[model samples]
Target: MNDDLKAAVLERCRRMEIPLVGVASTDRWEHPPFLPWMPEEFYPQSIFPEARSVIVVGLPIHLPVLETSPSIYYHELYKTVNTLLDQYTYRLASFLTDCGYPSVFVPRDGYGSIEVLRKNPVAFFSHRHAAYLAGLGTFGVNNTLLTPEYGPRVRFGSVFSAAALPPDPVLAEDLCTRCMLCVEACPAGALDERDYPEGLTDKAACAANSAELARRHISPCGICIRVCPVGEDRERYGRTTAAGDDDPRRRRAREHVRKYGGL
Candidate 1:
């Protein structure tokens, strides 16, 4: 394994102000970490034949902004984050290629639009799964990756590289508190009260909700992630309770933000 290369990658991420970065050997995909794993076609090596390692990076969603869900503010933030993820991964891939390791970046959201997602409800690549394998987080009941820093309130992007970089160990400790806040808050009734894999998301229902929100110019209904009490971000933002139970002043502020943003 290239320890020096891994150090250089870390330094680059630090310089870029990227908060989270992890590496995983492509072989991890061959060995199933959980049952009902994604098909072989979705693996990093399958997409890029020369890939020996996968690098995953995560960007956090601000809890305060996300609290104003189904609003134009959150929608714009979502788009901005996705754009940055794609750009960052592309830059990372180019950096690796310059070092003689051929690499390719995967788009943050591989689908054309919410309408396409409403029909298929699956992406060509799964960044959540990549983040899990890269040891950045673990799967939560809501079917999103939960990190100690940001819970499900984080977005991920990945790069496939030919360098045999040392891989980070998968997280052995589960970060989810099983509070069911996400399940209860899902506007689409898409989440269940069981653990992940067993409590897989109703992607079709979720996407349908997003489709309706799209018509209103908000596209993503982030209620589930917003209510999740898993991350230290909750403490950072001083959010003491779930969404609907907030103080009237704060509740009214969110309601007002929603009223003007969409159809």
Candidate 2:
């Protein structure tokens, strides 16, 4: 029965043009040994006590134009993708509810209110990591999800469901070979050379720089995503497609770029 449900969900996702999807027990994220930035109240168990499963979905962000003008396009693309994810999650929750299962849409605001952040400074856990553990994709050094087909060009969203769907087995693809390309590409030096248990990110620095960029109404840096070898390959495929070239991969890539700008 679980397998049949998984098949149905995957087919729906494919039809929706969502390239990556998975399921993970909500218990995993709600475990006691919490990581930094993971506020206890943010856990599924805390927010949706009855949620038994989470359906994670990943949409590729393969927009090459954003990379070209990082200060102008990245934020725009991110906002678009984030909005799309919100709508998608809401729709999925409605679908599950119609099917006689309880569902909820996890709020996307990572930065808590000033009062909440003061109480819990590290309130934004590695959401991308959580998405990966949910079997949606693999983690890259840049702290982004690297999908099998789209590398780090993806955004993740999930639906918390009361139904007990069998969890998707975690993926073992360690695509980040520690090449340090992402670290090198980070203009803000937000990536550390040493890998910490929580991953190698200078979250404070990244956030500060991003905030500053937001103030200026410019796109934040996407050098890490742009310089990634896998990202480059995806970009190549996208251009080919947009130009009406012979390669179907290129055509698909082009369409993605036209829609999202860049990752």
Candidate 3:
């Protein structure tokens, strides 16, 4: 019955057009540092006493759209993806409830800001960690989850439920190329091109840069994600603005992103 339920959940996510879905058992979790907004009890089981599983789902941010990072095209698409994630996860949570399993869906981003993050340096929950545990991705030097299909150009949401589901294995192979393109591309010098959790990225620097971008109404500094060379689209997108800054291809891609109104 548990296996059947898990399969059903995966199928439902697929029906909802979610590109990636992976499960992590609550027992398999290890809590990260807590932020001020995070309650003293911060584990999955702590959030929902009966939570037995976490369903992590990924939404791909169109590669062409991300090529225009820190631009209006990418910024709006970013919000659209987040909205889709929140709505779909809410639907999944409701589906679980209908199946006799209560659930809670986590937002893609919430309570995160330059001021708040500077003080706390963490979010109440980390969906990137959830996605990592679910075998969907690994951490990159940019402090984002790197996936095989889209690198860091993906957004994620999580659903914690009482339904007991078999946990997926954590990915054994790392996906990042340790390319310093992201580190160099970072206008704010936020990232230190190391490796996963050990690679230190200055969250304050990142936050400040993002805030400055927001001041201009862009609201995001996606230099790191823009330059990653992971995933199938890497060759198509190229690794850095310097690689082909004036390439007619680059300009065409940006126009394409704008034409579509976003990804």
Candidate 4:
């Protein structure tokens, strides 16, 4: 019964244009074997109580669009993607409930504001960690999940369910180059590349910088995502897509530079 239901969910997700899907048992959380367990408040069990498994979904953000980070172009795309993810997760949860499997959707944008993060850097759930457990990717130096297909250019959301779905194997490979580009690229100097999976970020500093960028009406800096070299091979495929030649994003970026004398 669980296998059939899992298959149905994956089919539905595929029909909805979801590119990546994986499931993980909640048991992966541990101190020594895996990364330390998240605090009880942030666990899937905390949200769904009966969440035996998590269904992690990935939505790819166009690499070209992300390359325009800290610009209105990328900012708008970010918001749009978040909105879509929220709606998608909600619908998936509804689908599971209708099938008699209780489920809950963990939203994409967990932090309401930098102020909220300052109060408690943790959220009720973490989609990235869920993705990692689901074998979609592993942690990179920048703390972003670097997927094999898209690197850090993907956003994730998860649905926690009572169904005891068979778990996906966790990815064992490290995808990051450890080039320290993400550390150097961070405008806020919020990262140190000395550690791969450990907490190497100054979340407070990162949040403060983003908040200040908001005040200036500038798109918050995502230099780490902008300069990541993991998915550069996608450029070969991007160039092959003839339809992207006259990309409006490219046109807008060129105009911005020409008029403002800035990149």
CA-lDDT, candidates in order = 0.90, 0.65, 0.79, 0.76
For candidate 1, write residues 1-263 as lDDT tens digits: 99999999989889888999999999999999988899999999999999999999999998888988989989999999999999999999999999999999999989999888877888899999889999999998888999989988999999999999999999999988898888887889999998889889998899888889999898689888888888888888778876634678888888888888789
Error of 2 at 111 (Å): 3.1
TM-score of each: 0.97, 0.77, 0.87, 0.87
Top model number, TM-score: 1
Q: Candidate 2 on 204-243: residue-level lDDT in tens?
A: 6776666565555655566676666554445555543322
List the candidate 2 regions with Cα displacement exceeding 4 Å: 30-40, 112-126, 196-199, 231-263
Error of 3 at 3 (Å): 1.1
Model 2's number of clashes is 10
In model 2, pairs of residues that clash are 37-122, 37-125, 61-153, 63-261, 63-262, 71-219, 238-253, 238-254, 241-250, 241-251
Instruction: Report the lDDT tens digits of candidate 3 across residue range 1-263.
Output: 39999889889987888989999887666553222223445667877788889999999887766777767887898889999999998999999999999998888776766667667777767788788888898878888999988888889999999998888888888887787788888888888866656667888888888777776776676778877778766655554443346578777776655454322
List, residue by residue over 32-115, the lDDT tens digit for candidate 4: 244445676777776778888899998887766665556666667777888888888889989998988889888886778767
lDDT for 123 in candidate 3 is 71
Number of backbone-clashing residue pairs for each candidate, in the order shown:
0, 10, 0, 0
TM-score of 3: 0.87
